[model samples]
Target: MMERPVRKHVRLKHYDYNQNGGYFITICTRGRIPLFREGDRLSAAGMIARACAEEISNHFPEIVVDLYCIMPDHVHFLFMAVGTPYMASVRSNPTISKVVQQYKAAVSRRIGRPVWQRSFYDHIIRNPTDLEETRRYIAQNPLKRMNSNG
Candidate 1:
């Protein structure tokens, strides 16, 4: 029998993921493939991912998808959760990790292939300064790539 390798824990310990706060997340394609094209030429798989990202708010009312950028190999976005009375009552309110997993699953189903890495990268927004900085980073990602390519 083959032993399964243990994966490293990426989430913060003792942190309540359901708590109302802003989260910046990055979901990379499997092996960091450049699936999304540059400029207006987004790939079909990328379109599915974009749609899934936009629809997260509809599926989970507490979540609000803020700024987002779909790069060639990865996608970055900022989402904030505004917990309401309804959210508090629900024992399994959707967390950022769950939302990202759903997004990846949706894209994978549409494309008929696994399109995501094992886990995503996330940063909890601590303040307005942190939020602004993350937003700027996401927005400039495409431009940075374009400059490098040229």
Candidate 2:
């Protein structure tokens, strides 16, 4: 009988994800299929993904979508979790995983198909320098892709 390979755990152990902090996240399409770009422009699916990402803050008040870029097969974004008293009163604890899952689900529902891979990649922003670098990376991702493609 063949055995399945074990997937490595990607999240930081014992870290409080719901605490106030910034997170850099990357989510890719299933099979790394390029479904979000076309000739330097975003496809319909990409637009939906963008809209959904933008609405994440509305759905989860504790989260603020700082910056985001949608590429052909993946997306990169930075979000800040600023805890709200109202959220605490409501007994809602929003985390990075929950936010990403909701965003993916919204995009998939709007597109009428499953479009995301099982899990996402994340980096916890440790300081001002890291945050600035992450912002630059997200801002420059499209240009990098354009240069590489052209």
* C-alpha lDDT score of every prediction, in listed order: 0.86, 0.91
Which has the greatest lDDT? 2
Cα displacement (angstroms), candidate 2, residue 95, comes to 0.9
> In model 1, what are the clashing residue pairs, if there are any?
none
Q: Name the best candidate (by TM-score).
A: 2
Pairs with steric clashes in candidate 2: none
Q: lDDT tens string, model 1, 114-150?
A: 9889999989999999999998998888888889878
lDDT score, candidate 2: 0.91
Residues 14-66 of candidate 2: C-alpha lDDT, one tens digit per residue: 99888888999999999999999887888999999889988998898888889
TM-score of each: 0.89, 0.93
Task: TM-score for candidate 2, please give it.
Answer: 0.93
